[model samples]
Target: MKVTVELSSLNKDDDKIFGNIYFEENEYAFPEKGWNDFVIIILNWWAKSILKLLKNISIEEELDFMDGPASVKVQYLKNNSFSLYFILNKEVVYSSEVDVELFTKAFLKELNSLIRNIKENRWESEEIYSLMENYKMLQKCFIP
Candidate 1:
């Protein structure tokens, strides 16, 4: 399974970024806030558990939109070589790679934790709380 994360248009677009995380065919595209929003949500929701997964990951870039690189990327080269390419404003910025197994483990762990909290209505923020409420309401719909 390939896990590709793409980030684009961060600096110039009102300092906002957009991104998509794909697990082979499965995709969890973040909202307009991009990966930063996802990170913020994870940190705000459960930092103590997922922060350790960052140990093996490293992203080095200018992060300056005006006088520096326009994008950033991260990928996993070892093992399965799950790659993440970050393009800023349709321009290539940087690339980061990491192990898919480790990243997926952490991702699923956090996702499970998040869903558990949502189901339990233990969100500390209104954003997530509302999200969970909507999710609960969505549960009533029968999907074929």
Candidate 2:
């Protein structure tokens, strides 16, 4: 039960992001083919939802992929476990069960990677700054 993310491309001019989310062997691509979207909003939502899950204050969360018309829904199960569903066009495309601890660790690692990527690319924008801040907050609040 591992989760990882790769932020492959960032369109600074449009503030659109392209990325892949890997849940073990499954890969979910953002902005789904032939479409592009402003992904920062959903990334921020995901980070905040993770915070709530870690704090045990929320049982479920659904995040839309903006113009992509895609989403990932998370349902918290007992004892640090969760069910994850990837939906495209309001249809469930993929689903998996994961351990939150492992997912968080991988998510944090990906966030660090993304931060480095942003700095190396010298992409500066208010939206990127806000996303980084959200990631920082999540890292700070995560216990493991």
In order, candidate lDDTs are: 0.37, 0.69
Q: Who wins the TM-score comparison? A: 2
lDDT per residue for candidate 2 within 32-144, as digits (tens), equals: 43344454556677778887887778899885665546677889998778788877788888787888877877777877787788789887777778889978877777545
For model 1, the run of ten residues with the poorest summed lDDT = 59-68
Clashing pairs in 2: none
Tell me how many clashing residue pairs each candidate has.
Answer: 14, 0
User: Against the true structure, whose lDDT is highest?
Assistant: 2
Stretches of candidate 1 off by over 4 Å are 1-78, 122-144
